[model samples]
Target chain A: MEAPATNNQIPGELGIWLFVAGDLIVFSVFFILIALGQKENADIFVQSRGKLDLWVGVLNTLLLLTASWFVAIAVERCRTGLGATASRYFSLGILCGVGFVANKSLEWGSKITQGINPATNEFFMYFFVFTGIHLLHVLVGIGVLCLLRSVSRSPGLNERRIRTLESGATFWHLVDLLWVVLFALLYLL
Target chain B: MLPFFYMGVFAWSGTFCYRVSLGTWFAWVMLLIYYVVKAIDRVEQEETASAQGQRYALTSCAGLLRNLAHAFGWENELKEKNVDPLFRKSMVFCAWSGLIAIVLFIIGGVILGEMLPPLLRANDPPEEFVRKVNEHLLSIRIGSVFLMLSFALFGPFGAGIAALTRRAEKSPVFSYVQLVFTSCGTLVAVLVAFTWALMAFRPDVYHPTTVQMFADFAYFLAVFSVPVFGGWCVVIALPILLAEEGQECFPRWVGYVNLWAVLLFAPGQLVLFFKEGPFSWHGIVALWIPFVAFFLWILIMCLSMLKAVKADDQVTGP
Candidate 1:
């Protein structure tokens, strides 16, 4: 079947759109709940937000945003039949993902050592659960990117394989978008 | 005199309380209302359709009457219409498993388990444990019975999912594997419930250490054996994700939800080491969060099954 029409006619199978939309809705609900919780415990939420490492959040945000850009560029290169260059972009994207994971682990490990955890308060609970779920998405996205990278390196890349790669890249972009929202909600706000 | 009796018991064994939590009982009430309303709706729709059949003279009203008969528990009169018998049966099985068995599980797992939380924990005195078990003896037994029934019901529930999934498979290998994993998952859940029940059976009669052993059995079965169910999740998700576009049993999103459920369930494995944190059995991350995800998974699968049933009915109209 032909791909579904996306914004600017995005390159991906139509089914990935459904998956992306569904995932966004789930995350939206989580964000709404976190917002409601912050309302209930404004003092605790504010204090807890202060305890979060802003620099780490900023670094992770930058990493994911850069990864998203690289993925977008890789998709563009694929469209232009630049497979070798696209593989390089995909590798960069994967490297950024690794950085995000490593940085997130260090941040979590520091907080845990400080004895600040989800059980400390409602705010921290939301912090851990929301970011924890987002981290899972990021990890899955990294795997998808690896698969896309393998496809890029393959000699017999067809239209179907390209669409699959594009679909995986779209999902990586989604992971980045969710992290941006999470960073803002959990840290800046 | 009653006050003195309580005082004496407490003085001898300390204050050990075992009673269902208010939240659990509240959830059970909500589930009951949901199923009751659904059953009513089903009956009403069947009645309306039967009337319409009589009015149209397009088909005999007897078929519709048979549906009503089936709803009222007269299975013999409920002849299979043109719909695929497996799909129809699966729908019915899922409904009962969700509505009845799940309600039972809430009573057994959530309510009763909460009442005796220390029973599942590794650190607790034998006397204190027996005291607590005896305190809520009746509810624990009833809850155990319900949990066992729920576990038994999951067998067909899994088979129903397998049936729905088989539609997209060129070979039924994955479907059979799903069936097997779902049954094994059900068995593990049942074993967990059984251990809890066994502990409550004669708490005072058995040695306190043995009772603690039973608790260990329950917790280990409940917490550590989750990957079996996780395997089922993968089996369920892979088929739907890989199914031919229009031929998928449910939407692709359901497959992703299954994958998310698998992810959500992963934290339960942490119960092995962290006995007190969020990864603990009583903790939000390990127990409550996964339970909520599982509930949503069932809810989505329920809708998917109904969708399958409707599509089948249309394809094989009576």
Candidate 2:
């Protein structure tokens, strides 16, 4: 009840954390279910996995990882009062998101052709559900970055500029984190 | 998949999404429930007027007893100056919301059942079908019940309470609770629609071919997350309300209720992950919400009393 913060309180780390929490809970649940179900249909999942070209997942992962790195640098610049520079880097981050989605589309197309219908195999079903849902979030984050770059020219924007970078960075990193857990669970392990 | 340009416009502008495929059978069912509640209100009002003439003070109060049970020791708390009046009112609304949720859930479920394919019923005569029915029926029915209740009771109750909790300066968490609860309510409404869609889309689920059943169930759960993704808002927002009065971060009861949701949901989602051939994941999904919802109802009663106990009696005549 301390006189409420105004509509835009220069949305801080808290905003990013909340977004990450929701995303993480969802992916975790989806992955955990897949893991638990894997035991019930290991052969089905493994065979389904064989059909998937994980090189695309690998490329998507690297793109996201690299994007998060560049985004971090963008946030560091914003902290140092380099707003214009931060804006430029955010555009680059958006590029990374676009790349990941393109690769995903190719990967998805091949699977559909191979008759790996999500409903057919438990593994393939989760594969489509989890990744497809995640791809949507990636696009959302990309859109956020693109939007941030557009109106970032106003004076005295620095105080909250880091937040713009931070939310996008948080989302990108979470995408990477999920892929990491997913890579091991889905591929190597 | 939405195109890049569309995502760009929505993301940059922070679009206001008021989507609910409103022209569905569930929309009609919701209208029916609304009409029934209105009728009940009118008839009850007339009965109250008639009974008042016969008895000096009507004591055949069926609702009154439940109201009393719902009342936490708040009146005494108010007398002793232990809580804030605004907080007390909000808690009182929470109690009413809980009650409305239970009643509406049953009504929604029965109405929804009217639309389902007759083949989904447990009474279908084939033995193989009967075996699948027994395996999946309980979980399916229970999930369906909670799914309906989410619309009828849960979301509206939260939104109603948050609306009542309005503050001139806006309590940060409290103000946010309104949007959160309203979204929760809306998600439930959509899920109720899907129940009819999936069943109607595949009436032969009662006697599905092996490949057909697997695809049907998998596809349903995947799409069904339209609600889960939305429902987590409650999980997120409840902590904000429970964090009031600078107590422990979340309401002690909410942590308990969430734990209940998890306890109920986790195992079922897991079993469902493995359940094949004529099982009811939807039913399993419904069973988790009500028991914990009612349990939270009890907690609100205790909180309301504690709130009343904490009420500041000074300048209270207003």
Q: Which candidate is the best by TM-score?
A: 1
Tens-place lDDT per residue, model 2, B236-306, is: 44554345332333223233333333323322332234333212333322222332333333334333333
Candidate 2: list runs displaced more than 4 Å.
Answer: A1-12, A158-161, B1-91, B95-152, B155-318
**Cα lDDT over the full model 1:** 0.73
Which 10 successive residues of model 2 chain B have the least lDDT summed? B17-26
DockQ versus reference, model 1: 0.12
Write one digit per residue (lDDT tens) for candidate 2, span A11-88.
334434534554466457666777876888988878878877777767877898888877777777776777677777
lDDT of candidate 1 at residue B143, scale 0 to 100: 75
TM-score of 1: 0.66
How accurate locally is residue A34 in candidate 1, as Cα lDDT from 0 to 100? 78
Docking class of 2: incorrect
What's the C-alpha lDDT at position A104 in model 1? Answer: 95
